[model samples]
Target chain A: MLKEVTAATFENEVLQSDKPVLVDFNADWCGPCQMLKPTLDKLAEELDNVKVVSVNIDNEDEIAYKYNVSSIPCLVMFEGGAEVRRSVGLKPRPELIKFING
Target chain B: MYDIIIIGAGPAGMTAAIYARRASKSVLVLEALTYGGQIINTPDIENYPVAAHISGFEFATKVYEQAEALGAEFVFEKAVGITDSGTCKKVKTTENEYECKAVIIATGSANRKLGIEGEDGLVGRGVSYCATCDGAFYRGKTVAVAGGGNTALEDALYLADLAEKVYIVHRRDSFRGDETTVNTLKQRSNVEFVYNSNVTKLIADKRLTAIEVTDKLTGETREIPVDGLFVAIGRVPENRGFAQLITLDDAGYISAGEDCLTNVPGIFAAGDGRTKDVRQLVTAASDGAVAATAAVRFVASLE
Candidate 1:
C-alpha cells in the first residue's frame, strides 16, 4: 500500500526512515497522476527495501515547495534524507523499477 | 527467437500486436511510458470512426484490452537500442534485451515544449503541455494556450469550459485546425484569440502567474495574468533511440512510406513516429495494420 505523507509527517516518514523512500509528488487535478497510480502501487508492493509514499501538492504545498516539485507525477528518490534522483512524468513499471534500484 | 517485437504500446503498436497475434506470430510489445501515448492527453475523441464521442483514455483502454485478449504479451520497458543481426534483430530496453525475427517501430510522438524563459522551471507549477491533464487545476482562473493547430484549438476549447477565461495565442492570423473546431471555440464566450502574436516570456516565481504576448506585426507586448499556460504547438516524433537502426527524415521521423517499410529489410516503422502525410488516429491504426502484415511476410520469407 502507498502511504500518504503530509508536510508535518514527511520528516519522520520519508526523511528519517531507514529504508529508501520514493516520494510521489502529485495533485488530484493532474491526469498523469491518476495514470501513474497503478505503476506506483505495483512498485510499492514489489520492492522490499523501499517505501513508497505520496504527497498531494494541493494538501501539502509546503513539502512540494521544499522539494521544488513543479510537476505532477514527479518521482523523487530519497536516500538518507537527501534526494538522490528525480524523474518527471509518467513512467512504465519496468522503468520505475530500474529507477528505484538505480 | 520471438517472431515479432514491437516497441510501443500506443494505438499503432497495440493494433500491430492484434494483427501479429492473428497471424499466429509470437508478439511482444514494449512501452516506455504509460500506454495510450499522446491520445491520453486528449479529453474527447470524435474523429475515430464508430466512436462518436468517447474519452481518449477509454478508447485507448478498449483497444489495449482487445489486443490483450488476442494473446499478445506486453511489457513496460523503454527500448534503448536496436541491432539488426544477419538473420534476426536484437532490441535492448531499460530492463532487458530480446531477440526477434521481425521488429516494428511504432513509438509515437511527444508534445513539443515552448522553449521560452521559465517554461521549463514552471512545468508543473502552472505551465503544462497537456490541457486535459492539468486544466482542472486552473478551474475558474484565467489561462493561455499557445499554437494554432488542432491540439491548440482543442486545448483552448477544453480549457474554456473549465477556466474563467482562455486566450488562444497563435503566431498565425488563422488556425490550422478544423473549421468546425475553430467555430466552436469562437462561439464560447470565455475564449479569446490572440492572433499573429507569440509568447515571449513566462512570468512566474513559485508557480506560473502570467505570460508576455508580443504582437508580431505591431511589435506591441502585453502581459496576461493567467494561472496556467498550456502549450500545444505540435509534437516531435519519438525516434531517437532507434536512429542507428533506421533512416530518419530531417524532422527525426522514421523514413517510411505508406507500406510501413523502413530502409531496414526486417524492421518496419508505423504510427506518428514514421514519416507520413497525416498523423491521425485512423492513420496510425492503418500504419499498424500495414506494418504487421509486412512483418509477418518477412518472417515467412525467413522460414
Candidate 2:
C-alpha cells in the first residue's frame, strides 16, 4: 500500500527523502481518483528507487495549495525537494510509468 | 482466445457484454480509461428507464458488476490496432496482443475542446474539463463554463453552489439542455448566463485569470475575469485510431447502421462513436445490445 501522508510527516517523508517521491493529490469523493488507486498500488510495489504516497487534498488542503494543485488525480513528481514533473487527470498505467521514469 | 472482444467499457460496451455473455459467448473487454466512458463525468442520469434517479457512477458500477458476474473479463488497456485474418482477428495494445473471433467497437466520444488560443496550455493552470473534480479549488472565486448542452448546464449548476460567481457562456441564444435545468440555473442568484457568445481566448500569465469571448452575432468582444474555466461543450467521436481499418463518415464517426454492422464483416461498431442520429445514454445501450447480438451470430456462423 502507498503511504498516506499527513501534515506532520510530509516534510520528513517527502521533501527530505533520499529517493524521488511520487505524490498523488486526491480526495475521497473523486471518481477518477478511485479508478487510479489500484494502478498506483501496483506501481508502488514495482519501483525500487521511487517512493509513492497519497495526500488527501480534502484533509491536507495546505499541502495541496502549496503544490498549486487545482484538480483531482493530480500526480506530482518531486526530486531533490523540487517538483520535476506534474500531470492532471487520469492516465493509463503505461503512460503513468513513463511520466515517472522520464 | 476469446469468442468476442469489446473495445470499450461504457454503457454501450458493458451492455454489449451483458448480451454477448447471455448468449454463452466468451468475451473480453478492453478499456483505456476506467469503465463508464464519458458518462462517468455526468453527475446523474435523469431519463434512464426503470432506474429511478441513479448517479452515473452507481449505474456504471452496477453494470460493470453485472457483466463481471456473468463471466466477461475486463482489462484496463487500450486496443491500439486490429489485424483481420478472415475468421480470426488480432487486437494489439500497449501491453499485449489478444485473439478473438469477432470484434465489437463501442469506443465512446472524447470531450470536445474549444480549441481556443492558449486553451491547451492552461489545462492544469486554470482550465478544466471536469467541474466536480476541480470546483473545490475555486470556492468563493469566479468561474465560467462554456457550451449550451446538458453537460454544460450541469457544470454551471455544480459550480454555482461553490463559487461566489458563475458565468455560463454559450454560442447559441438558448440552452440545448432540458427546460427544467435551464430554469433551475436561472434561479441561482449568483449565476449569470452569457448567451450568443463563444469563448475565443484565454488570458493568463502563469495561471488563468481572465477569458475573452466573442459575440457570435454582433462580433463584439468582452473579457471576463475568472479564477477557473470549465469546458463541457459536448463530445466528438473517438474513432481516429480505427480509421485505417474501418469505414468512417465525413465527420470521423464510424459508418455503421442500426444493426451495428460496419464495412468489415467480423467488425461491428456501436455507441456514440458510431454513425447514429440520436446519441443518448439509452441509445448507446441499445447499440451495445444490437452489436453484441450481431457479433454472436457472426461468430457462430464462423464454425
Candidate 3:
C-alpha cells in the first residue's frame, strides 16, 4: 500500500526510513498525478525494499517547497534523507519500477 | 515472438491493435503514459464521427474497452529503444525486451510548454495544460489561456463556464480556429480576448499570481492577474525514444507517407507521430488502420 505522508511526519516516516523512500509529490487537481496512483500502488505491493509514499502538494506545501517540487506527479527517490533521483510527469509501471530500483 | 508490438495506447495505437487482432495476429500495445493521448485533456469531442457529443474520457474508455475485448494485450511500459533484428525487431523498454515480427509506432504527442520565466516552477501550482483536468480547481477564479488554435478557443470556452473571467491571449490578432467555435466563445460573457499579445513572463513566488503579456502592435506590456494559466499553444511529437531506429523529420515527426511505412522495413509509423498534414482524430484512426494493414502484409511476407 502507498503511504500518504504529511509535512509533520515526513522527517520520521520518509527521511529516517530504513528503506529508500519513493516520494510522489502530487495534488488532487493534477491529471497525471491521479494517473500515476495505480502504478505507485502496484510498485508498493511488489517492492519490499522500497517504501512508496505520497505527498499531496496542496496539503503539504512545506514539504513540496523543501523538495523543490515544481511539477505535479514528481517522483523523488530519497535514500538516507537525501534525494538520489527525481523525475517529472507520468511514467509507466516498468519505468517507475526501474526508477525506484535504480 | 509476437506478431506486432505497438508503442502507444492512444486512439491511433488502440485502433491499430483492434485491426491487427481482427487479422488474427498476436498484438501487444505498450503505452508510456495514460491512454487517450492529447484527446483526454479535451472535455468535449464533437468532430469524431458517430460520437456527436461525447466526453473525451468516455470516448477513450469505450475505445480502449473495445480494443481490450478484442484480445489486444496491453502493457504499461515506456519503450526506450528499438533494435533491428534480422527476422524480427527488438523493442527495449524500461522493464524487459520484446521481440516482435512487426512494430507500429504511434506514440502521439505532448503539449508544448511556454519556456517563459516561472512557467516551469508553477506547473501544478497554477499552470496547467489540460483544462478539463484543472478547470474545476479554478472555479470562480480568473484564468488566461495562451494560443490561437482550436485548442486555445476550446479551452477559453471551457474555462469560461468555470472561471469568473477567461482571457484568450493569442499572439496574432485573428484566431485560426473554426469560425463557429470562435463565435461561440465570443458569445460567452465571461470570456475576453487579448489578441496580438504574448505572455512574456509568469509572475510567481511559490505559486502563480499574474502573467506579463506584451502587446505586439502597441508594444505595451500589461499584467493579468489570474488564479490559473492554461497553456494550449500546440504539441510536440513524442518520437524522441525511436529517433535512433527510424528516420524523423526536422520537427521530430517520423518521416512516413500515407502508408505509414517508415524508412526501416518491418516497422511502421502512425498517428500524430508521423509526418502528416492534418492531425485530427479521424486522420489518426485512418493512419492506425492503414499502418496495421501494412504491418500485417509485412508479417505475411516474412512467413
- For candidate 3, the TM-score is 0.76
Off by over 4 Å in 2: B42-69, B83-85, B94-97, B277-282
DockQ of each: 0.31, 0.57, 0.22
**Alpha-carbon runs more than 4 Å astray in model 3:** A1-37, A40-91, A94-102, B43-55, B58-62, B65-71, B186-189, B217-220
DockQ agreement of candidate 3 with the native complex:
0.22
Candidates in order have lDDT scores of 0.87, 0.90, 0.86
Evaluate candidate 3 and give its CAPRI docking class based on DockQ: incorrect
The residue-by-residue lDDT of candidate 3 on B1-303, one tens digit each, is: 899999999999999999999999999999877777766645568999997887665677788899999999998778888999767799999889999999999999888999987776578678988787667667788999999899888788888888999999999988768899899988889888998999999988657889999999999999999878999999899888889879999999999999999999989999999999999988999999999999999999989
On TM-score, the stronger of 2 and 3 is: 2
Clashing pairs in 2: none
Per-residue lDDT, model 3, residue B153, is 87
In terms of TM-score, how similar is model 2 to the real structure? 0.89
- 2 or 3: which has the higher lDDT? 2
- Clash counts per candidate, in order, are 2, 0, 0
lDDT of 1 by residue, B2-82 (tens): 999999998899999999999999999998877787676566789999988877667778888999999999887789989
- The DockQ leader among the candidates is 2
Candidate with more favorable, higher TM-score: 1 or 2 = 2
